[model samples]
Target chain A: MKRRDFITATALAAAFGLAGKPVYNVLASKDALASKTGKRLAMVIDLKKFEGNSEMMNKCVDACHSMHNVPDIEGAKEEVKWIWPEPFEHAFLEQNNQFIPENIQNNPILIMCNHCDNPPCVGVCPPKATWKRAEDGVVMMDWHRCIGCRYCMAACPYGSRSFNWRDPRPKIKNITANFPTRSKGVVEKCTFCDERIVKGLEPACVVASKMYEPEAMVFGDLNDDKSNIRKILSENYSIRRKPELSTQPEVYYLI
Target chain B: MLDKIFTGGKKYWAWMIFLSSIIGAGTLAYLHQYEVGLGVTGMGRDVTWAFYISQLTFFVGVAASAVMVVLPYYLHDYKKFGKITILGEFLAIGAVIMCMTFVFVDMGQPLRVVNMFLHPQLTSPMFWDSVSLMGYLVLNIVISRVVLNAERNGVKPPKWIKPVIYTSIPWAVSIHTVTAFLYCGLAARPFWMSAIMAPRFLATAFAAGPALLIIICFVLRKVSKFDVGKDAIQKLAVIAAYAMFANIFFLALEFFTAYYSGMHHHTQHFQLLYVGLEGNSSLVPWMWTSTVLAAISLYILINPNTRKNEKILGFGAIAVFLSIWMDKGMGLIIAGLVPNPLGYVVDYTPTLIELTISAGIFALGALIISALYKSVLTIRRQV
Candidate 1:
């Protein structure tokens, strides 16, 4: 091609690249828009429902893991857990009673990020990589901002946060093209399924659990008393993990 | 200044080579760690920090201990410490540099350490720790240089050095207090959540820091034409004795409160250290050994007869040094993390690579200290 023609072609490419996507386009692709007024996202898990339905629980775990591309490494030493089972006694040790029923004590219950009103994890972070969203109560992690210091993991009382010890990409069983894979060293956990919640969809785990057992998982806005989670929590008395710490955990477990 | 370090005897060269080889090995280990990830170390999701942080904590005390000598000599005009004040300040310089290195090496994304400055979080004690430590480092470097230069030229130090020297006293205290705050403020770990952690840190620091100086002065006495003075050594021993008393007393208070109150969470950490929680007593042997060694050192230090015997005092000083190292570096650090947030006895033993990297950091600090000390010694000789 002639030099003049080549110049024109390069100029055309630069103009397209520079003006291609506006700020709105980038924000549109991001997770969770400002939550609706008077709506605070919360979840209620029925402890009774998980009994002898371990496979169903595994499915819920897999759905969230697969959805988020959480690593599938073996061994508890370097496990990167998002959502998993914890024995009732260990999960609520502060509230444990000797006279409590054996079934509740022996059985394991599903647990994840509480998305506390006052997140201690956010408080300790030297960089504000993890923060509580203003619109909703969900504690969110900005992957780009994280220095992978793991102070957040230490500050989290419930052991919700997980660090990418090694390159998580290799261990991720199903390379889900839909989600971004995390680099090694960054902290990650349940973002309260912010991406899906913003899209007006329930979390992957909730959707997966509903398929096998609808009564097992409930997720909705806690501010709306009529919402499914609020309704369930209101009817059946529920307990939160380490409530005395005043983290004001949004995740509740219904007996 | 550089020529003095280069013009060393056979022993000095051997020492440099030994430190260098360890540093070289450590650098290789760090390279491998940087290539892979922190997973190469024993650190996991449960015990997120272990060896690196513990080393940083130990050295922060080492760095802060400089103020003990600095404050006495500079602020209070304790002239006995005049001969050794530069020694303490120079040691702080080397220690702060190592502290910074350990923090850097511990990072998952070490390259992103600049983020601490770029987007600083004022609420984080870690931010203040970095600030105070770096500030104290500069304070020492300036004060030591001014004094050493003034001495070499047969003149008084600049007028400005007095206030800067004064600032270093509290600045030194702040660095360790901020480091203590790093653990104490963590509401999650019951072991480190006490108000006394900062005091505990200071107490242990005072004992360990001067105990180390006692040994270093002895080494200096033998090696060079210069002597740090017998009076300075004895005075530091007295300071160390009082400090160790406070350290042991503070530890006893921790035990008393935990056992007497019978708070399950509080007692659990002690159980983990002493008896081993849930059949995992890996730290039991180490803690008991440290306790025994500490007792022996205290006995030697507190007694009037043994304190007068420099040979016995040297032995006690070494004991105190190792005792504090075990307590600060191993026992205290891992104890808070073992019974992790979820009641898991997740043990953390630094991998070979981690050990090498840590050794490398120690060697690096020794190299810096030795080089700086050599320059100072030469400068003193010329005067």
Candidate 2:
């Protein structure tokens, strides 16, 4: 070892030793903090952008479904969805205000798993089959581990999760090669484009929404103060579904 | 004892054959469900849990109701209840079997049930529900077997058996409470979130369980000369009356809190249960019939003059059982889901396959009860 480098390292170790802390303690603390403050991804939906724009909404829906291989079942009872639109008033029933404009009240606002910091789905899962990821705040489902008990469905106040009522493979016209399709007898939901995110690509719906002049959605790590989602969330007046339940929903809807 | 179950009268054999046929059909339907998924059932995306879960809730109550007899006989040292307590224990065994079967059939992946135990989590109500149920089942089995054997020999039960019997009394209460916890813990379901859920479950369980036993006892006396005695029947009637009253009072409280608070989450559930919500009221008639029947049963039970007459008493008992069956068996599970999380009304109607599967499970329990009673009578007579 070089004499100068060896002496400097020894000196730093001695300083830490004198302070009754190990030299690795500093590195360990940084790593521990980093894990504790991992990325919390969130989505911001601009409701105004979807007003009377059924064609644009359909495009966004198609992109997400085709990419995810979500089946297009015939009836509402057997329907499966990763992301879908809901009526504005129905989406936020707790805010039973009478004065929402007629057009806005009836307009369909996109809804999916809020991916809450304190998710009820994760809390109710008996086998730990469904859990909120520590690194990304995505409510993940392990289909193999799941017993398809549907307790997660009951626990979700937003109706975000869907159970595979039948085999979904036959109904999928085109399968997304990168993403794995789910089997029957399992519960599933929006995984926040987990595969795409790892590849350093934005969610499909977010990319699709950019085709129009006014972008309808923004997706980013909520932990990043400099990210566009955080900035948009702070600047605009927004609402979340069933916030009184104290799930601390990450998804924001700008009306 | 082994031959006793097989060596029944022609009518008994005919009844067994009838149940066996239904169970056979249900087994076929279940196979279809297993090959396909829960899609064949009437349950859907919105009302996810329906008939099977409702039956589980009802049978769990029936399983726990055995304690009503056990507590009075063992704790109070009431001698009249000694003979009837065995019937209660046997009924518990039957009910618990039904409970387990309902759960198994309801499961989307029944094969993965072992995972529940292998990865047991104390925090999960479903885990504790299984724990309490299995625990109660084993307790009842051990207690009933040991005590019945001692009775057969015309001797005192072992000292250890006393503690086990005592444990079962509270264990009975725990099974129903844990079952209620399965529903009440879900913060997303406002209808089941009240603290009164456990008490209401217990009250209904006590009423329904003993009411069923009364009917069973009447049948056993006529057919098998196995009378649990006139005084025992009267005592059970009184117990059921009080429980039914408590059950009614709790229902009233549920109504008052939900309607008076004016919370849509709370009121909307009751609206679905009692009246039509948004003109889609499939369960309205059933819920009203149950309520009216309960009130009528309460009247008959409360009147000592009517309660003493065997025919009148039988009618009251049957009414109470049916009333509670409707309440827990249909209303409890369905009402929670009607105005679903999105505040949209979606009704769940059990399909023929679902109904058949449920009937099969019910029949299986009755068969177990019949066999166990036959064995009990034979062994006791022989000894």
Candidate 3:
């Protein structure tokens, strides 16, 4: 071939390569879009609002459990729960004291996955079955990929994760068709209700709490200073469980 | 060479049959666990890892202890260990097989284990552990095969084998160290999150490994009229003694740090293991038994007169092996998980099925060791 023809052919090939968008570039552009939204989702639980309302707390638990299809297994050893009530002393050991106020001491605090910024569960999962979403700071689990090693359960300092000890399908009282139920031998936890968030809905528990008391549970983006969670955190004194562990828990409790 | 294992005497066949029965029982129990789930064991959400993980931890130490023999034989050119080096290597091959089997049976989804290789998360210590354990297993198998074949043929091993043998010394240490990191790296469990964890694991491994080897040597001497020499046994006893001392020293350091600092998170686990915490005292008796055994074994091991007596040395070795097993294999995992991350104490005891499955794995290890040793003895007899 002539030298001019060879040069022209090479130029045409390079143009096609540049023009036709590679798959990775498209992926990179999608990641860029995720960062553009750049949400750091967070939740703030106002314990004072939940002080005398055990009924309201139960409603929140039921809503989350029913929405997520969490099994109703009996006994603490084999029990699986997404959100549950724990005594104040058990939930916050660092804050326990002999002279604690009667109201605070008597009330059971609500607890769930903190969805940490630096989650140890994500770090310890051997199969990369669980990871923290870069787009939103919510830690997520892939039930199919989890080999059921339970390393994530051991790594979670909050006791937020649970394993399906038996077939969950039989245990489910009423399986939600929209949300998938996990099979036996996989770890499951709250994803900060990523499915609900994607559909522009607040987490079930947050929405449930709104009926009885608007300030009971607050969920919003921490990245946006104007967000409700950020506003609540800034105005009131709040604390997190095991904050010294440096996991940077996204969940806060308003005292 | 492999045919020698099939040609053993009546006693050998009886032992093989004994192990086979246990293995058969274990396989049946494991099938139940497979059809159901890990719930068949005593492991719950709180105490998520129990007997199986502890066995994995214990056997990794046993496997890594092969270094004690290999290092002295090759690195220092200690001719005393020459006769027994192959024994140590074979023992390692058996222990590693047990380690891998324990990991396999403990998984909830045993079939999905290939995901570890397919996905390969570098950040996870479990990933690094699988890599190191697999590497160590391959290294020991290659080194033992080459050296044993050379011995059988009355020739030196190929020049290429020297480097591989040398690589195995540190590789052995890496296997156990990585196993220790699997626990110690977790900041959530204060019982395991200590700087001394790796060193403590090595100390215990060196002690338990040699102690078990000495007992095996004694059995071989009685059963097959195979002696690895008086000097080798004495040397192994001394190695075990020093390692036990280091292990005790590390335990003392942990106790001091926990008590003196008076950190609730740190001291609570120790308190729970030693005494009952919140009415949970299931582990207290076990921990005390381990402590008493350690004390008795240390007394027997440290005295020169007692150490030189092969009869007493055998007892000391058994005591040492059992003591460390109780401490590391039984107490370590339970203490770490109980009083869990939330300071909730949940007692755990392995169910019948769990114990049966574990017994099967132990039988499998014995079967492997017996076959390997039989082959080695057959070769030595020809010489």
Residue-level lDDT tens digits of model 3 in B28-134: 99999999988889999999999999999999999999999999999999999998998899899999999999999988788888988898789999999989988
Q: What is the iRMSD in Å for candidate 3?
A: 0.8
CA lDDT, every model vs. true structure: 0.87, 0.87, 0.91
Clashes of 3: 0
Regions of model 1 farther than 4 Å from truth: A1-38
* Residue range B116-196, candidate 1, lDDT tens digits: 778877777887888888898888888888888898789998898888888888888899999999999887889989999
Evaluate model 2 with DockQ and give the value: 0.50
Candidates, ranked, TM-score: 3, 1, 2
Could you give the candidate ranking by DockQ, starting with the highest?
3, 2, 1
Report clash pairs, candidate 2: none
- Tens digits of lDDT, candidate 2, B1-383: 34667776687888888888888888988998998999999999999999999999999999999999999899999999988899999999999999999988877777988877777656678888888889999998999888887877789989999899999999999999999988897878999898999999999999999999999988887787688888999999999999999999999999899888888789988888888899888888999999889988999999999999989999999999999999999999988977888888987888998998888888899888888887898876621
Segments of candidate 3 deviating more than 4 angstroms: A1-37
TM-score of each: 0.92, 0.92, 0.94
TM-score of chain B of each: 0.98, 0.97, 0.99
What's the DockQ for every one of the candidates?
A: 0.48, 0.50, 0.60
Chain A TM-score for candidate 3 is: 0.85
